[model samples]
Target: MAEPTMRALLRRRDLGLRLVSEEDALPADALDRPLRWVHSSDLADPTPFLSEDLALLTTGTQFDGLDGADGYTGYVQRLSGRGVLGLGFGTEVHRSGIPDELVSACAASGMPLFEVPYRTPFIAVARAHSEAIAAEAYARRSWALDTQRALALAALRPRGLDATLAELGRRLGVWAGMFDATGALQSSHPQEAIAPEVLALLGDRVIDVLTRGLEAGQSLAIGAHPFMLFTVGRGGQLRGVIALAIDALDPEARTVVTSVIAMAGLALEQSEQLARSRRRLHTQLLSSLQTDDPALARRVLGSIPPAPVVVAVAADAPVGPLSDWWERLRAEGGAASFVAESPEGVVMCVSADDEGLLDQAAERFGIRIGISEPESYSAFSRAHSQALAALRQESSGAYRYADTVGASILSALATDEARLVAESRLAPLRDHDTSTGADLERSLRTWLEHDARAEPAAAALGVHRHTLRSRIAQAGALLAMDLSTFPARAEAWTLLQTARD
Candidate 1:
């Protein structure tokens, strides 16, 4: 935090800082250290974009040679009023020794003015300031590395998702929530509802950092608040996202977050690969059983024994920290994956093969999980569907196939029957019929997506406004629901979601 003094600045100047009036008000201690870009605009008011930290290097050129009857006094007054740190008045070009009126105006306004003798170029000052700031930043980074190591070694309970997120939030001194690429909460600290603003900010960053097929990590500052980000990768494709926030965190805290994010990313990628392999095996085993040949099914099962698996999916994700929570979930269970997404909430694909895996994950605070019924290797697809259905119902209890009649029986209590019914009833609105159009449902969605702006939606869809109006009218008539209504909108949304599924 050693700031550059006026003496240091003067030394950096090629002609050396000469004492003209010998009445320099700013002490050597008060000169700009890390000055933001130098400004010498001749505009009467350059305050449109210049911030407070700017070192305004004007040459009295804006006065138009005192074109106004008030002399250059008014011009000086305006610059000082704009919160400029100091003024550099060019002396040689317009020499009559800077108008006494201008000097008096600056002094009275409490603005520091420096005489820029004709010999000195403003570029020199800009270059010197840049170097000073760069050096200071480098020192901070070096200190940051050491602090990071110390933070990593801090003792904490060996728990799962909740513990991980809580630890990070505590260390960073900020409320932290982990999101999957689709922006679902993987794990959160000070876990309250997240604001749309926060989500939007992180979401934009995630898209920027991750490639369609690649997953990686990055960091950014939003409104001056620092955040660390990571990518979820699997099967040679990016899976989800992770983000952590640290506002005014210490150097040590920042380093610790960086390390945690990196470690988390590695863990998530590994678990995802494991999940994919298990899923592939499960599919192959089940396919053999479905082939109507018992012996072939046996051979398939013998080739790849059915084992348990776990699932996790991308929720409302952005370029926030993804790796941390995924890793924690893995430690709690045998494996994890970005399962799938739906409006109800994020679903995780967990390989709960062994006994007591759910309890183990819960004990570690791994993730909020609802397990499905278990079956042998020959029913991978069926097992996966049951698990997903159970999750969709948002059941609090762990469901087992054995708990029901048999593997063929899907646990009726495991799913949200009411929601399913509602969606099913609205199926027509979500589906496409030849009488309507190839993508009638999609067209309806696009129309609604633009906030019901008929003209804009029609233009974007390459349709006439009248056509869009007629389609909406026809959809309303067929569904027997006016989608412009709030309740109707919700129903329509559910319909669209079911169709997408």
Candidate 2:
């Protein structure tokens, strides 16, 4: 249904209205212009009271005092220029019939003129228009309520947004499409009907929408087609955009579009909420695994891969693509693969045999990965250390597996325990050096580094072999450690590594 237009009002012949202008003067298309309200003003300059698309009725009371054709012509021209739908001249109150000058002026200016006989009061036309307007408004309200109900039902369907958008497009008799904030097309109905030009138009408008921060709906032209765009959210949030192809949207169609925007915005919000919840869970699980809390990690993740797990850490990796990698890992490694995002990079624990899988992924995604040797769940912390060590050694942007035996001793203690052991064992030496400014600990460290070779140890210390040996003997005496024993040498080396770890 259409709004109350001039053509619709003119069809009511009960008031006996007559068109005084040339029959062809009123264009058929112009008759459909919407009529806001019926207004009657006798003031010569009633432009202030009148607005566009209104039919102005007059009695010529003010015109009776004016001079000849110029006054009447100027009067008609003023009404026409003010964009009134038409001028209604009421006869017998002031004039007997329509003035010839006014008729000619109306024709020249393309303004439709009508005559109201003595029997027909200006109030009669106003009353008829008022009733027609009320009827149209009622019809529109009824249509709007019906459309809203239909949209609500569509939104509740099992398919959710897809069915809702399809229903909208069906109702509007056009193709409808939705796009997320990333300019990715989420969905579209009757995909074949989505012309390339329409997508291009939306692309162009997106730039404008982002730059100008447009939150309201915008009606644009795509070639000869009409396109209506509405932001799915408010306050510049831009949850998404809904676009439909239609020449002109009536009140009923606009009502449907608005309902779609509301539902779509709600759906988008819910989707984001779910994603955030999953991300929080993933982060929690990652924290537990990274902190070497295997029990907590298993509890948080709900399950753990079977023993001999291969842990890997990546450096400078893109987090956005990690989600995709996780899903891919689940496909390839099934229940044996697990991935999580860490602050430094992404971390993963897969079956030891899946080392080749990590290598393939790193190559495919152009990322560097560091893999640990086969280790049980009890050694997850050790595996992480190996992975980190391997990561530090990586410089070729390729995956590197940890040298199991070379770093195995360091992995025996988790990072924190190693730090404690190093601090406790080296405490006496550290305190003595702090007070006396001695090089006893440094000398022992140099000797151990050179495999107890006095010549190299002396060269490394920049001292004579005798002096180096003397410092070592002094360090052993101060700590009550036997420097000549294998157990003592091993303990010293382990302490040295912990201090560095």
Candidate 3:
């Protein structure tokens, strides 16, 4: 015969029975078996004999008389508070019937109490509860199988990565995210807060789970956020992990998590296979930059990335929105690849597949971008190392982008040179401009700062109209640089940025 659900177990032949017990029943489900036996006796609290193994069965036995059952309420109350499941009472044992006090407490505390007539055997009741639970298990298992099959089918479809992720999320009823081993978000639930750190951590968790051979459906919470982590493999080889997160999920959601991980692993495996050539190209490109062997490097880099490239290193903390910043970059017609340096830094490899896009990104990224020349892909090593040096050499938090040839030259402390030369050349003027009386220097700085706007700069400096104007010209002469020309102004700005400690 099929088992029954808990709801069915609670609705047996008892009615209006006192259930002043089971106040502490733990909210747990039996994975293997439903509860079976219950015993009811007139004993003063037959609780002492049975320990952890058996649940207590009770009835209004010896409690009617003060001689043996005095203050029986406390005994039942304590047993119920200790998490005893159901309390039983025989109606004929005492004409008074089950205690109303016990039943009321049980309901308030979420515990169930059962009443029994002399004809209903406690053993029979236990059998009914066990049978009910078995039925629920069968039903859940059947549902899981159906959901799994549906998810596996969708995952095998030929949707793009974005489409696939969206589909996977819908099927799973939670947010789905995929990130590379390095933690860069390859795809995430659209418009989500999948940051670089979160992406990397998800990858790490997947590897850890698979390496440990954790059971597939096991889940745990991270911080306040809940996640289902899976060790995924594709085409018979493991690729990366996928994280499914949300508050408590329904059974359908849980099933999708399991199926999607399996399918996504296969998808990723196939993708890597299909992308072997592109990956090789990327590797070759990066390799060309890493080495000093020009003959070998140039051969590998070839004529790819016909446009120039630039490298940028995070000198301090990253500022503003990375997506917005990176999107503006893509709009510039450049290809952007990101890698984690550590918690402390990030690096961006920027190249103009189309120079216009690169220009647009530069304008919108709003960070001091560095520029580099059209070195073969093999030149990445040299570029990255040089970029790091440039990062350190420049102001700690300023942005540095390699400029075509200018980047390699400026980045190389040796052949590049000039940080010192630029600093030295501009120092006398720096000092002279500094001592121009606080009022004068302030006025000059404001004027230069506001593009020499007489009124606006004057308003900012809080100086009289004429005082602000005179200081601007005198300050420019002292600095030995015209305050007007684009080049002079740019050089001055660079000097200021470069000289800043």
Candidate 4:
């Protein structure tokens, strides 16, 4: 399916073309240059009307009455400068043979010179090249059809997406990679074909396009490596991107790529639908487990996570990506795990021994997770409540129920409403201290910390007991509360504990 070249034309027995210039005079790849077309002109300057990569056939009429080699040299220079592949001389029609000066000029300029005998018309050469072009085009079309059929059959395999991508890479003789909606590398043909740095660059470009939510293709080169990236699925709902390591594709090759893109998009859409149904089933199974009936859930899932399992709840997590992660784990025969969408966010039940999976998920997705204590399926509801309580704690990354045990009551009361009430209740003491330039609020908190005692509180504050007592009394007066009463002291302690710094 390659274009015809000068060497190919010279091999045509019917054309009877002969290379007049010495082989050494031509550039190494001169004869191998692809000939786009064959044109004949008798004008003194045909450079303006000619294009690159084509042969210009003409009789030696322009050389008539020419004296020196200057005219011939300029003529050859013009044709070469215009990117004309070669010059063909039609002998006998003008002066029985190519002029010696013209041949010398062509040799000096490295212009490929060939002879067109009187018996062979210029039309014959053009027609032969045109026929070759048509034959090449037809062959390409046929190859495209056959490759499309092969890709379709590949899509019907067990691992349709992977199989189709592999087939595409094989057919195109290049590397192919598939990224998921989260911009994670899902699959790649010839898995390690791309270097890590190149892959990182590709990932960044893919993320940029995905963030824009566009259905488009981009051609880029990282150093000497070239890549063609295309977004799969529709705009604003893109499933992923497919990257091919190639500089450019012909029209027929583009048709093949387009077909693969459509197939990949369809496959990913169907995967999304199947994931939704699977999540629904997981949610129902989780609900069944909450009812203290593990048997029904176990029957459906073959087996649940072992008795000592911890339930994790993550708010605003990407359920699709997490589900895909769990699916991969299952495929690898890792510990049994279940993921589902809940009112809180995404919920997962995994073995306590495999809690590291939760850490991995959190790190991979940049999400915070709350994990409960290890408990049996019989207490699944309680475990879920514990995880929810842990989720409410002021923490980042993975917050566990165990980490909350014996923690500060302030952590539990760390909410907007509680902070507002605390600020309001302690405002009088704060304002009074600020106005008087006294440390009454500090003394009061110190006294509370000392179990409402005076001597130790004074020692802790580096002040006399009488001084501490006096500050406490002043604080009580400003707050309009009796400092000696249990209710007043308890209320002050609670307010101080709940207020933020």
Q: How do the candidates rank by TM-score, highest first? A: 4, 2, 3, 1
| Decoy 2 TM-score against native | 0.58
Higher-TM-score candidate among 2 and 4?
4
For model 3, what is the error of residue 430's alpha carbon versus the real structure, in angstroms, after optimal superposition? 39
Query: Which window of ten consecutive residues has the lowest lDDT sum in model 2?
Result: 319-328
Please report, as a residue range, the 10-residue window in candidate 3 with the lowest summed lDDT. Answer: 26-35
Error of 4 at 295 (Å): 2.9
Model 4: per-residue Cα lDDT over 413-450, one tens digit each: 66779889989988988987888899988999999999
Instruction: Tell me the tens digit of each residue's lDDT in model 3 across 1-501.
Output: 233423345556453233334524524442112344444556766666544323455666555554433265566566656555555666664655666655555455445555666666666766656556566667767766766665556555666545566776775556777654323345677536555566556666765665565545447665666776555663324455566676555565566665666566667666656555544454454444456333553465453333255555553423323333453344565455432233324445555444344344444333433333334445665666656555554442333434323554424533234567666756666676567534444555466678867888778867777877677666677677787787876666555444533
- Better candidate number, 1 or 3, judged by TM-score: 3
lDDT of 3: 0.54
For candidate 1, lDDT tens digit of each residue in 123-220? 77767767766776776676566545443543244544346556666655576766654445566777653466776776767655654544544667
**In what order do the candidates fall by lDDT, top score first?**
4, 2, 1, 3
**Span of 10 residues, lowest total lDDT, candidate 1:** 312-321
lDDT tens digits by residue: candidate 2, 1-501: 667877676677798888777757666656678888889998989998788889999877886666677887888788878889888899888878877878877887778788888998888899898888889888878877876787789889996998899888987779898876644456788887867766876766855674466787788887777777788777656666887887578776787788788889899888767655766677687667666667886776677676678888877775444544455347565545676677757787877766677776676457888888888876777788778777766365544554534556565453676788788878888889889998777788889999988998899889999998888888787767898897888788777777852
Candidate maximizing lDDT: 4
Question: What would the TM-scores of all predictions be?
Answer: 0.36, 0.58, 0.49, 0.85
Q: Considering summed lDDT, which 10 consecutive residues are worst modelled in model 4?
A: 407-416
Whole-model lDDT, candidate 4?
0.89
